[model samples]
Target: MGAEQNWIPTEIGPADVGAEATPYGLIDHLQRLEDLTGLLTREKALVFRGFGVTPGELDKVFDLLLPNRLAYVHGNSPRTKVGQNLYTSTEYPQEFTISMHNEMSYAHQWPARLAFYCEVAAETGGATPVVDGVRWLAALDPEVREAFAGGVRYLQNLHDGYGFGKSWQQTFETDSREEVEAFLAGTEATWEWKKDGGLRVAQLRPATTRHPVTGTEVWFNQADQWHPAGLGDETAATLASIMPVEDLPQSVTLADGSPIPAEWVEQIRDRGLDEAVNVDWRPGDVLLIDNVLVGHGRRPFTGSRRVLVAMSD
Candidate 1:
C-alpha cells in the first residue's frame, strides 16, 4: 500500500520558525491580513499579534489553524472532556500551567495535528511543554509498545459534577441512552465501563501512526489506564462492573495476576505533565499544538477564563 504523504502547506510567505529574526515582514503582513484560513490548515499554525479583527476573523483563523482533520482548539473544549479546574476557584486565572496530549485520544476519530497560540501570558506559571508522542512511545519496551499498537488502551474521565458534576450521561448532550452508548462506542474503537459507574474502556489501535507528512508513528493511547488494577477483590469487581466490559472478555490484569504498579501510573502522569504545553490567555489568544506529536492540559486558575474552541479533520 502507498504511504500517506499528502501535505498541504499554508500560504503564509516564508515564515520559518527556524529563522533567527522575528520575521517582522511576516508579522506586519499578518496583522493586516484579515482572513488566515487560506494560510492555516493541516499545514501549520501562524502565531501572530496586532490584528484589529473580530471573532469572525478568529473563526476563520481557527479553521485555518487546525489540521486538515481537526479545527483549531483551545484548552477549555478539550478539558471539558478530560478534566480541568475552572478559573472561578483560583486567585489568578492567568497564572496557570497545562500539559500536552492529542485533542481526543479516547475518541477513535482523533485529529491528525494540533496547533495553539498564546494571547495572554500570565505574570507567573503559564508556560507550555511539548514532547514528541512517537518518541515517548518508542522508548518503551518493544513488546510493551507493540501491545499498545494493537489498539488495546483505556481511559478514566472523572465527572463528579464540579461545575456540572453529574454523571457523563447527564453531562454530554445526546438524544437518549442508545445515542449515549453509541457515542461512547466509537465505531473505530471499543470500550467497557468501570464498576463505580465510571467509564473505563479500551480499544485497539496502531502503536505508530505515521504522520501524513512527517511519516512518524505517534504514540496515541493511554495504556497504563487500560490495564486492570488488582485491588481488593470487591473493589476490582465493582470497578469491572462500572467499566466497559464488552471487549475485556477477562478482567484487566497486569503481566501477571498482580495489581498494576504505581510506577506506571506515575510514568504516565509524569510524561503527561512533562510533555504538555500550556497557555494562559486574554480571551482572544488562540492556541494550537501539533497533536500527533504532543499533549496538552490546563492548571488551576481564578476568575472566568472564557474560551471558545473547535476541531476538524
Candidate 2:
C-alpha cells in the first residue's frame, strides 16, 4: 500500500478474498478479520466491499462484528431506526456536512467500536470521512488545545413534546420521566424538568481521553458540533440573533462556563475535515472502526443514502 493510502480503510472484495458474494461470504470475511489478529486495532478500520450483502442478511454480519450491540443511549443527533440497534446515520439534512468527533465521547462510558453498513449508496458525494485521532489532535493549534485543559460543559435543552428541537421523550427514547431522571442521575449530570415540560441538562466532560487499549490520548468531544460558532457563519449568526447560547437546543462551553471563541472551534472542525480520509460507499459495503482511535463524519451528498450503524462495548 502507498503512503498516500495509509488512512484509507483496508478493503476486501469477494473475488480477491475468495469468498462468494453472499451473506456467507461476509461470514468468511469476518472470520478472516479474526484470523488477522490486531488488524482492526492496528488499521483502525476495515471495509468489506463487493460482497452483495443485503439488508435481510445484515443482522448476521452485525452480530459477528458487534456481539453485544449496545443501544444508542444518550445520543444527540436525530435518526430513524430501521433495524435492531441499527439506524440511518445522523439524519441531519443531507446538504450539511457532519463534523468529526469520536462517538459518545462526552458520556461517562463510550463504545469501543462502531460498525457501519451501507444498504443504499448515494447517487453522489456521500462519503463517511474518517480521521486518525492522533492526527486530528496534532492538527489543532496549541492554544486551542490548552484552552480545553479543564475540559468542556455540554448542555441540552429538550422540549416537553411541542417546541423547537427534540422533545425529552424523543431525546431519551422514553415517555417515562422517571426513567430519564434515573439515567441522568447515573451520569452524575445536573438536570431539571421545567414547568413548561422541557428538560434541561448540564454536564462537564473531558475534552480528551486516553484509549483504553493503546493508552494514547486523543481529541474526544462534540464541542464543535454543539457550539453555534462551528455551525458556519450564517447559521451561527442566525442562531445567535435568535436566542442566547445557553438557551439553544444544544450548546457547549468551557468547563468553567467561559465562551469558546468561534475561530478556535472552527480550527478544530476544519482541520479534522482537512486531514480525514474519505470512504465512498458502495451498496453492501461495511466499515468497522475502533471508536476511540478514530473520529468520523459525513460529507454533503445528493439523492438517497442509507447507512446503518451499530456499536459494541
TM-score of each: 0.55, 0.95
Q: Which parts of model 1 are misplaced by more than 4 Å?
A: 1-46, 50-56, 66-98, 115-123, 138-150, 155-166, 170-172, 181-202, 224-260, 272-284, 299-307
| lDDT tens digits, residue span 1-313, model 2 | 1332356678877887788888788787786664432777778888888887888888999888887888777788888877788877889988989999899887877889999999888999989999988888888899999999899999999998898788888877899999999888889799988889899999999999888766878789989999998889999999989999888999999999999998998999999999899999999888999898899999999999999999998
Instruction: Report model 2's TM-score to 2 decimal places.
Output: 0.95
Window of ten residues with lowest summed lDDT in model 2: 1-10
Which regions of candidate 2 fall more than 4 Å away from where they truly are?
Answer: 1-6, 31-37
The 0-to-1 C-alpha lDDT of every candidate, in the order given, reads 0.43, 0.87
lDDT of 1 by residue, 278-298 (tens): 433543454445556555555
User: How far does residue 303 in candidate 2 sit from its true spot (Å)?
Assistant: 1.2
Q: Which candidate is the best by lDDT?
A: 2
Residue 235 shift from truth in candidate 1, angstroms:
16
Number of the top-ranking candidate, with TM-score as the measure: 2
